[model samples]
Target chain A: MTESSKRSRQVTFVRFALAVALAGTAGIAWMSFDLGIWDQSGPGPGFLPFVEAIGLGLIVLAGLPAYRASSDLLLMPANVTSILGQAAVVAAFAILMPYFGFVAAAWGIVIATAWLNGERNWLAMLLLGGGCAFGIQYLFAMLGTTL
Target chain B: MSTTEALLHGLMLALQPENLMWGFIGCFLGNFVGVLPGLGSSGAIAILLPVTAILPPTPAIIMLTGIFYGSNYGGTITTVLLNIPGEAATAITALDGNPMAKAGRAGAALGIAAIGSFVGGSIATVLLAFGAPSLAKLGLMMGPAERCALMIFALCLLAMLLGRKAASGMAAALLGLLIASVGIDPVMGMPRFTFGQPELLDGINFVAAVMGLFGMSEVFVALEQRLVGKITENVGPIMPTREDLRVSVKPILRGTVIGSLIGMIPGTNSALASFLAYGVETSVAKDPSRFGKGAIEGVASPETANNAFANANFIPLLALGIPGTASLAILMGGMMMYGLAPGPFLFRDNPDIVWAVIASMFVGNLILLILNLPLASMWIQMLRVRYSLLAPVIVLFTLVGSYSISSSMVSVWTTLTFGIIGFGMKKFDLPIAPMVLTMVLGPLLEANLRRALTISRGDFSVFFNHPISAVILVAAALVLTFLVLRLIFARSRTPSFDSED
Candidate 1:
């Protein structure tokens, strides 16, 4: 794709992301209002949240003009894959932690991240992963908190 | 206790072998993190905050403070040898430092930075010791209305200074307030945005949020960039020539003055001190053209300014419970997690913690000076390590650290979720510091605002009725108006790039 087209795609993505944020803020504002903003004594619990959410929505709307004028692009597709893949590995670590336990789950995280980082040496990755996993276990054991 | 008496007592406590050892470990770990390209002082501190949970409050804070300043010294090593600054403040150091390295004067450059750092840091510590007590006294006089106004001043200034645009910064700060409201409401006991998770009652763990935002996100960026550095220049003698020192003395003193003044200002970047110092040095030079060509004064000024800025930033944090920078904000979070409230009461209630931390700064700077002078090459060798090898270890550390916060999957999930959010924030050019700072200060702001309102029977003018609060609120308004006008004029001229003026 051409540079201008890439720029347009980036702008569209940012606008969509920002629109979602605005909607979320508006929803929170409504919820906070429903909860009550004031009581007999003074400002209630929802007062701060309601004020902040409303302020945020206004700020986002004000910033839109500057956003339109700016030429910056948010994400380059080439780099996004690497970041997303690594994020996925971390997500999987949280998922697998209960079933596989700390050692196995942590070991998978180390190995997968290292592999994704382009460390092609299998034996090296395995040794590093195993060492880190056991080392963490020993640390927690020393601290009297079993992982 | 008197300031002198308290300081002497604190020095004795800092000299204890256990506290000293923790301080040393903090310096070592901080230097290690600062020597690397991607991981910064904030990330390292966030990831290691949980480990401090196992220790006593004094030693834990001593260690964390050591990390804060030690990283400043370590950043000079990469800037001198690899031209890759290990921290944002060190970016100014690379302008002349890299050129000096290419000219075979890497040792002189590094040596000057070390001496400048030592001198600047020592002077700033002395100033902080004398300054913080008086500042805390002033803080003690503040009522809730005044305190709320001060925080408002800080938040508004931070939103304007930290982000590329005031609106973005204001948006981020508001979002932080919303995040802070996620737990059970302190007043009404109603959940704001908890989604019915029992774990949300205690609120989102600050350490988990920071580790995910700064530490894990950094690793993700590193994996994408794949940064690697090779040492090409030999570090000659680890001492500057007498001539070099003679010329650097003035800059060092000037830089210290510049840094010490800037550091106490809430919401200003420590990096701003370094950049200002460099600019001052260049503008005052006999031959300003020699700056980018490897001027010794160039290396000396920013190095000294940054170290001074690092130490001097403690004044605001220790005295008024306000953090001046992102790393200091994390340090404040760590202090709260340890059940220590930082403010005027801290000096009155916990003089031992306050004074010992101050004394430890002196000791940590001495240790860093010794370490950097003779063992500069050891740090340079660290540059040869690849980012690929470090990324996995960092991820594991962050994950385990998050899990250890509550020993549950909830904190870990928080970490992962914030990590992704942090990445998007970075890409979208939103400032993360304002978000983190507001999140840390949100409860205080809310509580104070409510108390003032209640005291006044819901009269919002109570804030304007108090002299201190009125002055501070007016100042905040002026600052906001100035920033908005400046933004309007600047945006009209050109389309700026991300995170830059």
Candidate 2:
């Protein structure tokens, strides 16, 4: 594999590993806080969740050996930057959703995302992004499904 | 009771002006996406799924189904003319097709493919019309234990077929199962993996996951390549010679049969079917050396198999209400959203709708045959457009498509996250299809397994107690064993399959 490819894989493995670890820890911690005893039915509310978290953790742990043997990190810096940038775009829209309502939020998301994708032409972005938002809003409103 | 009566009733529903128009529109849109690589039936269906939420169930499903198979037919165009496959299923077409194109026989290759697809699709649709109810009845006889075993068999088969490394496939499948275990436990109605996030209480949306894994990942890869240039090449005439037709007939027939059978198997995808058909035709050829060098049979078999499998893949969904692939999974969601169940009873309860849908396939195939010939030249023109223009549009749609699924920005983020992961996996030569298949099947396998165990008083051996379940389990075990043995043997020798991706 190319160096960049190898780095990309490592980054992914590390991110997944961290997510798994955090999930497992949270699950275990949550179980102790509430629901003093595990419920009798098949599995309690926390039982499967904790089990899943631990399972994910173990899988991630197992991957470390493979990662070490492979001679490459799982992710590249550019990849990380892109992933983080994409996440920030979504987060911005999400934080604005309640204040802006669905139309504003949707339009904002479409335009922001399109620009992030490298379409900097203001008119083109608005035409494509704003038009899509309007079209979707119209369709959803007609269907009576809450946006 | 009569065929004429059935046909008339189906035509009545299918030929309604609105329905007919939607069918044409669906076919047209489907062909457009299919001509583009990195887009497939599921993405097309997902993008339009919101539209279906507004329309009547029957017409909505009919249009969506038209798009599904229509895209399959359209995919072969790129594979034959350019060396690029529009979908993985069309990859085999490129083997001989590119050679033929270079030989200035592009017209013949495309013509043979179109004819072969029509013949294959028509046969499979006929089989589906007559045999669906019977197969569904057979499926109904299977209990939860059998279903679980069947799912296991499917996972095993898919791993063997698609995975570069069996261990990694198993790990990926296990991770899918882990992911599926999120949300509230189905039996207890208690949240499991929400981590106190209200949004996660409903669990990760399948649509988001799919969009991320397949669609977003594709965009990331495109970006990484910094691809901004147009790719256009001169394509020759649009008609096949009489000799070309004669040479292609047998392979088309062979591929059609092979693809239909493979498509019936739950986890065997069209790509594998096409590959297998190509391998078979080449091996059995009188002159094997001619196989990759513009052999007409090579083009004929994969194209025929690809379309045949696309049609036959509907069998599992219709019979057991279980989706055998990603696209079918979306169809299942569509059916449920329409408040129409897809199991054995659907056939008896909704014959007119069912038969009309089947009948529409016949019409759709004919439409595609006519449309593809004239449109081939135009589609080739699309390839001339630069990636810089296409990339932004694809990115815009990907974001919009992911967001539209739940109106949740989290889903959009998930798409980008998974896209990067997908790009990484691609770089490492990991097979993404297995991950996709597992992601789709994970929850079904878990739900059925849990249901079977609960029904049998937690007796784990219920899986083995049933005859069908036992047989499927044994088959899965045997396949696993064979794969392990093959790996060991290969490692000890030349390590022929070491190159991943």
Candidate 3:
């Protein structure tokens, strides 16, 4: 695809994202109003959030028109596989940390990330990953923080 | 005690072994991260904030502050050697720095940048010393109303100045304020948006959010780009010629003045300071054409300005409890985490921590100069470390850092969630600085607004009634009007979508 066409697609994606955010903020404002914006003493807990959410929703609405006419490229397309792999590894690390222990989970993340970044040497990846996990664990222990 | 006498005492405190050691460690880590591409000082500092919990407030702040300014000096290494700016603050340096490297004058560019940064930093620290106490005194006079107005003014300026578009900036700032209201209300003891999660009662963890937004998200972006550094320039002797020094003197001074002045403003940053310095240098040079073609003045001016700006940014944070940039916002969060309120009362309550931190800046600047000059080649070799190897380790560190905060899975999950959000925001063209800055200041803004209202018996005019608050609100109104007008004019001038098609 041409560069202009690519930018157009990105712009479309951004508009969709903004719409979602607008909806989210509108919902938040409704919920905050339900919680009460004012009380006898003064402004209640929900006051600031309600005000801010309304402001966000309005600003996003006003900004949407400008974005429709904008040709500015928001994001460049790159290696999708690598990006997803990295995110997946981090997510997996978070989940596994509860069951596998910190070191094991950490080591797994390191190895997986390195592999996704195109490290093909298995021995080097394992050694480096293991070393990093133990090293981080040692540093945290020295700080008296239980990982 | 007088300012001079207190400074002397602070210097003595800074020279102590533990303080000096932490300063050195901070500088070392900062330099390491600065040499690496993609990861910035904010991210590095965020990743390390939880670990600093072990130390006393004084040394912990000194270490974090060390990391703060130390990264400025470190960014020049990659810029001069590999033609890649290690951080946004040093991006302008690459214009001439890379050319110098290609011409085998890498040493000269690197040397002048270090020397200039040291000089700029030292001078700015002196100015900060003379200015901060008076500013803090002024801050002490502000009531809750005035303080709230000031925060509103700052947020308005930040939203307008930091965002690509006015509406986007406002939206980002408002999002930040809403997120900040998630926990139990400080005044009413009523939870706002906890969603039945006990962990949400305290609201999102600051360190976790920062680590996710800056550290983990940055790694994800780097992965997508497959960023790698390749150093192709030969670094000659680590010294600038006498003629080089002669040409750079005027630019250095000009850059310092510009940096120090811009640094005091609440919404501006070091990156902007450096950019302005570069623009001034190019405009003033006898042969402006020499810029971007290996002009030594190009490297000297911006590098100096950014370092100067970094040191000067401390004034607002220390004095008025307002962070001037995103990184300093994190530092402010760190200060609050350590049980030290950052505003005027902090001077009376924790004079030792305040003075020691101020004194350490002087020491840290000197340490950076010494380390940068003699150790230039050592830092250059760090460029050879591949990103493939580095990314995983950094991710591990961030995860542990987040987890270390309150020793729970909640913070880790927060980090991961925000990391994705951060990346998505980037792709959507929404700048993250305003979000981060507003997030840090959100609770304070809320508390002050509530206090001001409660004091006035829910009078809506309270914000505009007090003299100080009225003046500040007027200024905010003026800024808001200007931004809206500019946006309208901008839209009128642009070509429509149908025309493009």
Candidate 4:
């Protein structure tokens, strides 16, 4: 997409994000108010959170209109696949960590992420990835802390 | 303990093999981090924060600081060679540093920067050694009201100085407060926004948030722009000529003084100090035009100033518990996570931690100078490593780091979530530091303010009633007014700062 159109898209995305943030903040403020904001002599549990929510809401509101017509978003063809691929690698690691343990889980993360990022030589990847995983495990062992 | 005595004790602690190892690691990683483009000291520290969690507070902090000053010292090499600033603080250095490379004095430029950084860092550390104890002692004298006011002053000042847009800074800071309100209230034990998640009962992990924001986002950006920074080939004669030293020494000293003072201020970022030093040096020179043409002073002044600014930034963090800049803010947060509070009570309550950290910086600076001197070629090779190759390593480290925190997936998931948010924030140019700073300081800020009010039976005027508190509040108000006026003027001149400014 064109730069200007790209910018407007970002602006729109930001506006939506801000609006959601506002709703969240306003909801919290209402809940805080219900929970009690003041006592007989001083501020209550909800007082700080209530004020904080209001402050956040106001700032979101202030910048709401400025984003109008800035640009429409278009996905850049480059690197989008790689970014998603990297995210998936992380997700996979998180999912596998409990079962595989630190050393095994690290091996999966290292090999997968390196492969995703275009390190195609399997032997070389194993040396780098396996060595890295073993290195990390060794470090943890030395520290007497389980990863 | 007296400053001298504490420092001596600290020196002993820092000299221990474990602490020395951390110092060496911090410096080594620091140089590599600085040599690479995009991620600065704050980002590096954030990613590495969890790695140091297993260590004691003193050594953990010692390593974090080594990463910080080491990055400042190492950032100069890329500027001198590639003309691309390795970090924001070195941008001004590139203006003169790159030209020196073109003139085939790349080694001299790099050499002078090393010497300047060493000199600047050493002097700043000396100042920190003296200033921290005295200020901490004064901090000991302050009441809740005064301390609250100081926090307010720092937040306002940082927002005004650090934010590209005044409104965005203030907004990010407010958002931080909201984030801080998430877990159980320290005063009442009632959850604010935990949403019944047992994991968040204690609150969002500061290190997790930082790692996601600074570390993971780097992966995203690196993916977008595949980085392969230029290598300075056959970097010749890594020594400054005697004549070059004569020309540079005075400016280096001047830059150190200028950067030292500016850095201690809450919001004068290191970049600004470097630029200011450059401006001052150029203006004072007989042939000002010689600048941007490989003038040794051009390389010397900014290099010195940036390191000076970096080392001096620790003063506020260690002395008063207020982090004016992002890097210091992260270190301060990491300290808190390590169970060391950084306020006035820090000196009295944890003299060992305070003293050891100071002594470690002196050692860190010495190591950085030595590392940068004869070992620069090795450092440069690190720059040649592609971002694609680096990405997997970071992902692995970050995953392990997040999991190591609580030995649970909760922190990892949280960090991953934040990484996406941080990447979005960067794309939108929303400043990350203010959010992180407010998160770190939020609970304490609220507690202090509440305590002061309680002391006065809920009187709003208690803040104003205290003389010191009154002055600080007035200063915060003045800064707020200045921000408003700046916003008005800037809007009048341009449609959007992102576009026009």
Give me the displacement of residue B243 in model 2, in angstroms: 2.2
* lDDT per residue (tens digit) for residues A1-147 in model 3: 997788788788778877998899889989999988898889987888888888888888876766767656547648878888888888888888889988899889999999988888888889988999899888878876777
Q: How does each model score on lDDT?
A: 0.83, 0.68, 0.82, 0.79
Q: For candidate 3, write residues B357-393 as lDDT tens digits.
A: 9999999999998889999888887777777888887
Ignoring the other chain, what TM-score does chain B have in each prediction?
0.96, 0.91, 0.96, 0.94
The digit string of per-residue lDDT tens for model 2 on B1-501 reads 554566567767888888787777778777776766556666566555544545677787788787787777666766776576655677778888888888877777887888898899988887776667678778778887887888788877766664445655555555566566567666667676577988877777766676666666666665554434323354677777888888888899999999899888877777777888898998889999998788989988988888888788777767766566667766666776576777666776877777788778888888888877766777767766545445545554666566766666787777766666666666655655556555556666666766786677667788888998999899999988877777667634421211111
Position B186, candidate 1: lDDT: 70
TM-score (C-alpha) between model 4 and the true structure: 0.93
Query: How many clashes show up in model 2?
Result: 10
Error of 3 at B10 (Å): 1.0
Query: lDDT per residue, candidate 1, B316-359, as tens digits?
Result: 88899888777888899999988887888898888889999999
> How displaced is residue B303 in candidate 1, in Å?
1.6
Write the number of the candidate with greater TM-score, choosing between 2 and 4.
4
What would the DockQ be for model 1? 0.73
Model 3, residue B13: C-alpha shift (Å): 1.0
Best-matching candidate per lDDT = 1
